[model samples]
Target: MDALPIAPYIPQHVKELLNVSIKLIRFQYIDYSGILRCRVLTASFCLEQDQNVKFVGTGPAALYASYVEGTDTTPVAAACRLVPDWSSFRVCTYAARHASVMCRIYETLNSFGFRRCPRTCLYKVLEIAEKELRCTFLGGYEIEVVFMDVTKSPPTPFKNVVEWSLMEGLRGRPIEILEQIAESLEAANISVQQLHTEGSQGLFEITTGPLRLMEATDALVYTHETIKTICDKHGLVATCFPKPSAAKGLVGQHLHLSISSLENDPIEARTVDAYIAGILSHLRAICAFTLPSHDSYTRVQDRRGTNGTWVTWGTEFRDVPLRKIESTHWEIRCMDGTANVYLAVAALIAAGIDGIRSGRKLSWGDSQKSPSLMTDSAREELGIKTRLPLSLKEALGAIKTDLTLSSTMSQSLVEKYIKIKTEEAESLEKMSPEERTELGIKYF
Candidate 1:
């Protein structure tokens, strides 16, 4: 078994944590399937005097656990260690006497981070952006979830449906649940920019204020966990599945991102241009991570506010996937809650850095109108030369062919990821839309 030392990972404020009556410590990590997995230890166990007593063991396959029912997707027979990043520690507001800390996966006690660890991939890319490119990123997610009363036969919406942003959506029990969620997040120091009803039955959207890349992802995970925990406590289910119902229209976890110089100076115009260009250039391949699930592709239809199929960008345009808000800020409309956010964000930054390094230019013109509304010649004149991969299989294929993007994320990890996802796509392809939707609601 791999051993993770407790001393180095423990925070200086251990006494403060104990004073809060925190009894259980959860070492959490996001698996390849975007599911949050954890191992719990009693707070007393962490105070052991014997050095040999301070370790937690995990199987390597935990990183490759399938979305179907948490089964191992790979046959790797080895132990893995969970090294807690003490910085991510926060009191579990939803669970009394509990705390959570994000972890980094290691193959052995002495080894560096595991190659296939999604968190590790994100850290490496972030470091490259800061140290090499002299840039740092800030981002936040617009989370959309559909609440259901699972106790009902076939399940039904937990609240009476209302129009988008209507105050009635937050009335009664719904408001109570959201208030508790907001309070929990605030206790953890995660800012809530806004919370409102979405344009779908039983769907609600929570937008968080921007933070540094890693912090933003961790907050998103925590926020998701908080929402589910609160809903479960009230006998409801919250599913982040995009296109949860084929007829209910699409809902996604859209990511808004911005970049600034590492020293906090104004970002260079060329750097911004190349970064956006880089993302647009590699948009097709990046979809493998952003719009990951089989159901995710169903949300990519044209003229449905799902972000159009075209590989381009426009200023505040909902039809295009990449919507530029300013020279430094852009909103990526393709991502969903099914994505492993760390890996998704890493892929985006890496691709953008690749463009910055290569000094690529943003050649595509700003699409003022949806391409679907434009004539063929009109789109051609605007340089909308490519389209997003239309299916999970096609997206996987795109990632495989984009050697630069794959190599940057580590070729071995990419191959393993592709293998796991290829299996998922094949398995999902055999099922009907209803079955797929049911499976999605069950897990995601």
Candidate 2:
């Protein structure tokens, strides 16, 4: 028998969703504060060919809502639009009758992306890297989360302690929860590289396979949502907060990145060297994006198994903030779950591209040991002259002072981000330690 043909006029993405029996399409975007927001539409409404059907109006303040209280800081008069990037459509296997598509914010329905939109900013930065530097990047992230049973008085974690990456850590219900999360993500077309327990109490890490920069970030956001949703079903709260448990351990969102020459050509030795050098040079400033919250600084001082405190790079060294995995591949350990993934990636890539343009030299020697362990003279010999910012305030100062880094992004965007984060840090500083942790748990 002959096969029936697909509809020629139907949008491919819509058709794919309809094929999977999706009844609702959710237009989603991550804001500057790293919170995911969405608007929903019936699949039939989205299937319309009209361009107006693809755009959803939102308030300008939606882009800068404060992290804690959800306060809107922007003027109320201006409005924005969410235009779905159909290419990023993915079925939400955990949510029946629903699908999700990442959206780009625009000033008007007919306009290009809004300058303040983190995702749009990232797209522009990636375009620069591909067009000007003749390079592209593949990136992956390690999502570390702690699950707490909110039913308890103090919200206790799983009573059992799970050793890092050990088989014995796989237990009954907790393991089942993790298994379901992995399977659901895989069903959503996100590649799950590995799932294992971390040393922290009730903490688990999911390693996702790398994709091109944009897709990888999209996957990271979706992964966070999936983890939260599946855990809620099991009567647990999953938080990616950097310091969810102050006494137990910290959580991180370690990033792995690799660079490639355009068209699969061999990347030059100098290009690779400069890229790493660029990142190191701007490490402190980049922290403003990668580690944005006051809680994030808690991880910096605890060097036992946390991100190293000093600014340096080393080969195959977990203690260093930056680890050179190979010539073109590297691991950044300082990043945490508090960051907007889009802005973080954009800053990192822009720094690397800046390094290439300036022909920045790799002046620092590879450290055989953590900078803290080495003698001052030994560190000086290796040109390890700087420390990662010690606090959220200091990190914001670093961003403010680094004109070279700020020049890469839109001036208004940088100012607004800095203002928002600065206010958040100030507000967080007023709360008691317990209050801060509780708020982190509630919203993260």
Candidate 3:
């Protein structure tokens, strides 16, 4: 109906280049499982007056249920249109002739629109944050991915280098690919705060600075695509799968978040407290969207050292699911690459908005010790009674019963998401641990 919001501010040079030199446009969106999907068009076709919105078959909406196995489901069995948000356009650093922009799905080229779209869902949550709380959500991600040499029968780690954050860990093609990924990200106007090796073999992390909610999610998708594309060009596979192998440690999509008033001032303490409280209250339910796969639970469970099993928060504590950072932001460590970035972020913000609106008290105290280590009596004393869902099915069950979260995110979308994930979780349950891990690597 209304014009899309103006693109976040970009450098004048980039703006000039995009207006004059961009030749092709890619309309990109992520399915429920965070897989990147795209449709390409010539710059001329995109600029035509009649081509403002492009048609995309509705099959992608059921991507979570049918993408891995070509089965059509009800929620996405029809056709939809992709309406590109010109404001979100960015030059494709990996492809010199192409540029990309994010899109929202619509039921028709001219209509009220499809409300169940993942991007639309996120935008709705952001609007609630802005209108009700008078605060804008800001976020960034620490994305971890593992590189593998797929030439082998079973993809092997790209290299044996396992030194954490060490330059020596990236020696041959890995270093070159990382450098290119960094360069490509910057070229797309996505700031790279840091890029370093992780503790696992062939694993690395890229940290980006915060942007407004939608922009941050867009950047994250592009970041994943850039890394994967570059690795492919180098004849290696880059997977953000939560746990490609038990022996190589876990991969996480750690989210850092903050809030600011409409006037751009930092939010007050009460607001921050309420927001964090909301997240804690709905943490278990929200995991259905954040950690959407059976393998995701395996990576987050106790003994993974990822701070996933407990529902606790603390300042600078790595063993807590929600860690307060720099006294200004919070990091959610339960998520992984399997999550649809849009859905994950939307559910999180929606839950936080509920907290702010309800003025819910922040109950959980700072826990220096891991929940796994705390005695049952000690945990009871601290009021840390809740545990995160240990399986995809359990997480979906929690979501189905969570009134605040389910109501905030529309019941229709939540129900569809649960159905799809339930099927996936049940299917995975029939397999052995090794089989499950292999399937995770293959699909995620």
Candidate 4:
């Protein structure tokens, strides 16, 4: 159906987010890939507390078009939660875009079939984080994305060059849009760090200082929208698609996460080892969430023996599924700009936290080369178990059956995720491999 854009009273949502009285309400929805897309309206207590308010659709928010035909008739859908930390002023925000086009979006917190979408799935993960981890996860994230031409008329290499070379120095659709985003982020309580071009052509990365988990994710949502607006103004497209099915270049959102102690401690102790174990143990399965696309497998392949293996690990090799950095946390390399930011971050944190709570031993996988760079046997023995699923079906099977993971992660979320991913695979299966790769949306 028809989605009517609505932007009224959204400022009230923003006001509540800021005051100690209002809780943080997040408005969230699902796009075509069944990934959660969001717009963080605001965190607040009372509308009376503020006179000025701001609303925005973050980078993750730009994933869905308000006017897609046939499916997802509901557009105005929203889900809101109070920040676990703030019980007094209680900051609550809707993950909504405030445009009239979002009218059909469901708003009830307990609505059934609502959880069918990944947004709700994310909510479920947060719930688990609360009960099991027994710690409040707060911190900002660094997200990377690539912008380029994929409309098929022709590839514009210079546009990509301009995006990388001139983003911050000059002012254009890219910079102007990001400036609005930076402003919106500051208003939302998320801090912005510096960002720049990444390895792939047309690629860009935004690094925000460590944020409370809520604000960090919110920053992602805002950045997504700002980038989209800038692209549209310049008659360009900025996509978060994992492998846009085109040679436009690889696009994936990398997550740099650190968990501070809710218990007032600064370090997580062996929490690092435990987190590593859970991630490595469940990595093959985690691939379903991290890389989430058929085109992804192809991206992992080497052009001339340059690309190798099913999984790799390293402090250096970028191809590895798990990359430990000099910093306090690990950088998951397999994820691409393709998947949902909320979903990827939630899945990873859930897995990592699961390891911590269960006292799971994170076998320090090989540090020599990338997990993708090493032999399968060598990787497997060092707790690099379970080959990364080449197919979405395989990944679903892995996650669905893992007794340890299932106990913590929602089974409903699993079923819903599988349903969405299965449809994606089936749709792609209709086309030949060449056709699939050439669909040219942006990833493989």
Give the top-scoring candidate (TM-score): 1
Please give the lDDT score at residue 52 for candidate 3: 38
Model 4 quality (TM-score): 0.68
TM-score of each: 0.94, 0.93, 0.90, 0.68
Q: What is the TM-score ranking, best to worst? A: 1, 2, 3, 4
RMSD of each: 2.6, 5.0, 3.5, 8.2
Model 2: lowest-lDDT 10 consecutive positions = 1-10
Name model 1 segments beyond 4 Å from true: 1-7, 49-54, 69-75, 109-113
- Residue 18's lDDT within candidate 4 is 52
lDDT of each: 0.83, 0.82, 0.77, 0.52
lDDT of 3 by residue, 283-386 (tens): 98999998888778766666556865888887888877888886558898988998998899888999889898899888888877787888998887776989
Evaluated at residue 102, the lDDT of candidate 3 is: 85
What is the C-alpha lDDT profile of model 1 across 328-353, one tens digit per residue? 98999999989988889989998998
Off by over 4 Å in 3: 1-20, 49-65, 70-77, 108-112, 263-266, 432-439
* Candidate ordering by lDDT (highest first): 1, 2, 3, 4
| C-alpha RMSD in Å of predicted model 2 compared with the true structure | 5.0
Write model 2 residue lDDT over 367-435, tens digit each, in one string: 767789888999999989999998989999998988877778666678879988888888888888888
